[model samples]
Target: MEEERNTYLDELSGDGCRIGGYPIFVQYGPRENEELRTFDTLLLQLDCEYECDLMFGDGGIANFFINEEDLKKLDFTKVLYNWDCC
Candidate 1:
């Protein structure tokens, strides 16, 4: 059996990150009209005003989306990086 993806904010609410009441996604695919595809990661559809006011607008840049105020706000302990430093 396949394991479930607990990659949603609701699934991660226990960590204390503000969970947007609406559904967010960890979607993967190429951007519209581009050849080099952007990779997928946990992302929030953000309001253009940057209020954290819960009004979601166009999808924000992944880094900006995960940021609160000016500090970085993700717990990467569960994430694995297999890149070679060569």
Candidate 2:
């Protein structure tokens, strides 16, 4: 029997909040276990304008915003590196 690949996002309240017009959900994955993962980082572009909020394990709340210029210069694959180096 194949073990079911568990997915997060099944535990958040139905009406938590909306980010960049997409509803935020609690997501769990190998990379991010038991955390909130937005549908698209693009939503971070909305920033404070939208109500999307991320609560880090350290209890840090980060409001993300990505403008056209920021997006153009962003390397999605190296997000962790950027975060670490910055």
What lDDT tens digits, residue by residue, belong to model 2 across residues 1-86? 22332223333433332454333323322224333332234333111213444434332222333343445676443231101100
| Per-model TM-score on C-alpha atoms | 0.19, 0.20
- In order, how many clashes per candidate? 0, 3
lDDT of 1 by residue, 1-86 (tens): 12344565436432222223332333432232253222223233332244564322343222122223222445433321111111
Instruction: Name the candidate that leads on lDDT.
Output: 2
- Candidate 2 C-alpha RMSD relative to the actual structure: 14.6
